[model samples]
Target: MIFSALSPLLRSSALQNLTQQALLRMDAETAHGATISALKLGLAPQQTHTDPPELRIALCGLDLANPVGMAAGFDKNAEVPRPLAQMGFGMVEIGTVTPRPQAGNPRPRSFRIVEAGGVINRMGFNNEGHDAAYARLKGLRVPAALGVNIGANKDSEDFVADYVLGVKRFADLADYLTVNVSSPNTPGLRNLQADEALRRLLNEVLAARAKARVRVPVFLKIAPDLDETALDAIARVVLATDLDGLIVSNTTITRDTVAGMENANQTGGLSGKPLFNLSTQKLAQTRLRVGDLPIIGVGGIHSPQSAVAKFEAGANAIQLYSALVFGGLDLLDRIKRGLAAAVRAQGKTNVSELSGTQVADWAAGKAEL
Candidate 1:
């Protein structure tokens, strides 16, 4: 009954294309559920286990097969982490898991804007909670790096206490932990991104981890919609801590970039192609503020060029969610292939060399997308 033998990348283009078309025909939530079910059932195709050395990089004390990771929102629970890793991602992050389970928003909370290659979702971090996810993760085997994105429950009395619980619960379980305070779906979630709130949250989280037998690196996932002043405050707050890294963006609430697209006015966070420039600029700007802390850029990455652009914008690594929603697992393989080619073309041995090269332009808001 072990689904360990399935490889992730060995699929015919025709079959993958057909699968994508079929998924698109369903509603967004339905398509998402079906994809997770397929992965859990081990019905997805596989790829060779080998990762090119050029794309090999270290983040948060873990070696990744590649810089590309399956972003947190992809697997809300720990149901199919192994299957997703088997699908060719260098790392897989599961959950926006809270201390308690919640149903999230009502039905039709997720929407697809096909015309703009964008998605707007207000799923509200619905998950099976830390205990369930921990039980599933306790004995799981996955080939790639593993991370957990932790969040506070929507109805929790004390948000900091919830994050502390996640830190204590997953410090030994995850290769790294991401404090996701930027999600726009949960009311008052983004408030934690403010300087004092973030500082207190991290203090509690790190303190909880400090008591753990095994210390896990804690990364922060932030909102990209912050103004320069707010972003500067966040950068300073993060740089002041011993936090492991940063994921420069969750999803955006603004729709200015994809205004005329279908479902553009939906009441949720916007992700995918339209978020590219703004997110990248924020990543680069954050890099300028925090000199050596590693950052994982996410938002709007769907192509090899976009992957390379993330590195150029000061990311040490990157994560993809919305892009994969549109492109499927094949996109991960193509991105790795394309990234390796781009790195070598620039005569680089280590992919980390590509980080922050154009940060100045991006930080100054002068970088043309």
Candidate 2:
């Protein structure tokens, strides 16, 4: 309760130090080892018997154990699925893996904007390639729903072929697949989101999914920087093509919200607290346009209130990356607890019932913010 009361102020500078200390405690190898170690310890022993079961989110016919998920880019190589699953994410999405191996952009690409609670990365879809990623996915013993984030190689001329090849190669290994056409870091990537190009790209990828004989849901990830007209067009194409769902945002190129932050001018997509409102607004707009299509909300969720805001904005589930970098692991538990408390306070039995229920309120609130 003391941390709760102080969170607003703590979120400013104190939280940054705490997160840095946490990050310093674990590098890639140690993080992986720690994750495995935690899993071996098992589910935190369910400390509070009186606590309600966390929200179970259902997407594209797959049921998740909770509404919180680790967004793509966290475990790019699919190396930490079992450990991530044990961390209690409703689901975990791995990769952004290209058809071929990629070294990504050069170092200093991923920068943490602590003051803004954001990260700007031009990591250019770095991964061990689809084959290697699939092999790792196949080898993991994750207890939670697993998804694959598929992308085209940076240097590839035939974008659609890359997606098609990925579907053919990795579809069966995943519970769901995301076609990431929204990343701003790769040259010519966001161009795929244009109306005509989107239609063609989606049609080809969906067709490839069918040919592969796999029935897993295929979702599309979009950028938050789109205007209303662009969002409408994109939604229309998804509906027309019958795609499974939409991850209503990857990151943003705009720096309007985090204008004063230290690394705010860095040339990459911006994510974290700065993107919370923008992405949520787009989520609401996309939900309005797409009607019943499920949305996986990603962007700047750093607290339970923000998670609730995302649910209110029409997200079927919520995902975060920058928050973890800024707020540390405790942020997840806090959000989960806060979300459950909010649902109970509202007299709702399930988290799904709250989805989109407050869109009008969220829109009104955003206007005020």
Candidate 3:
């Protein structure tokens, strides 16, 4: 009611000025921390039954109250999972943590392209070590599904050993685990996305998972920057290894879409609005290649419409990070409502029913619009 009454005024230049002022005063780190804190206090305990059921998704034997999740990088140290899970995320994936702690890239690493409603971050894998992240996860009380994102330290000569070590130490604590071989920020990290490297890494990690008697699902996070050949190769590798699901993408190195923005030149993986189409397209291709395997679609999801688009593109679940930075906690509820409505409108019973439903059209380039 208040929003309706102020609708006209809200569209005015005054409101835009005020909004910019608010954003200008907050950096990404502060914004992310504050938003997680609010979610912890405001939405964590809310009943899921109060929201639409169509928003829920099941992944790796865990029932997520909603398909919406917090992607890797936000809680690099695993400090905010409980708060984030409580805040209303279906799941929270923490870290990109390496075997040992290392300072990420130099400052000015995170840049907000307010004009484009996007962000670019090259904060390497700056994280406290696995032990630190594991300690924090050990104390989390939230009921939401939780996953840990593991990565190789930037300077490690034995990168594969770093990943194996991560699985040995943190896999036991995670409901699931993600091998982050896709982050473009860390030097030589993206190379791990190559078929041979990924195959070797997954083999070792799976062995470690078996050794720990940890039957938890292991998913690989890939880069959206891949071409058809690379993606196809990745699919083959996943199939050969019999690994679990794939997080369709991490972030992209492409800036063709947001080149007009002031900070578009910033180095890092680009995310948010600029990434939506590319990521979804890649997701569609992945779904086609992988057949029935689950894919977590992420990147540029700021609204329920985008979330549904990902669902239509073949994502079993969806994740968000850049959106919260731009839209605030209210965005979660809005996405939930919008996704529920979209699902019902399509006459779908649950989100799972809609996965890969539009792949043919998406692949033909006819459905994206």
Predicted model with the maximum TM-score: 1
In terms of lDDT, which candidate is stronger, 1 or 3?
1
- Rank candidates by lDDT, best first: 1, 3, 2
lDDT score, candidate 2, position 80: 68
lDDT of 3 by residue, 88-116 (tens): 77888988889899898887688888787
Query: Model 2 over residues 1-369: C-alpha lDDT tens digits?
Result: 001111221233423443335543543333433433443444222222222564876678887778888899877878767766665677889888998999988765766676777778888887889878888777567777899999999899899899998888887889889999999989999999999999999999999898766687999999998998998789888889879999988899999988877878889898888889988888888898898888999988988888998998889899876777556566777888988998899998888888998686655445313
**Whole-model lDDT values for every prediction:** 0.84, 0.78, 0.78
Question: What is the lDDT for 344 in model 2?
Answer: 90
- Worst 10-residue lDDT window for candidate 2 reads 1-10
Better of 2 and 3 by TM-score: 3
Give residue 172's lDDT in candidate 3 (0 to 100).
70
How does candidate 3 score on lDDT? 0.78
Q: In angstroms, how far off is 217's CA in candidate 2? A: 0.2
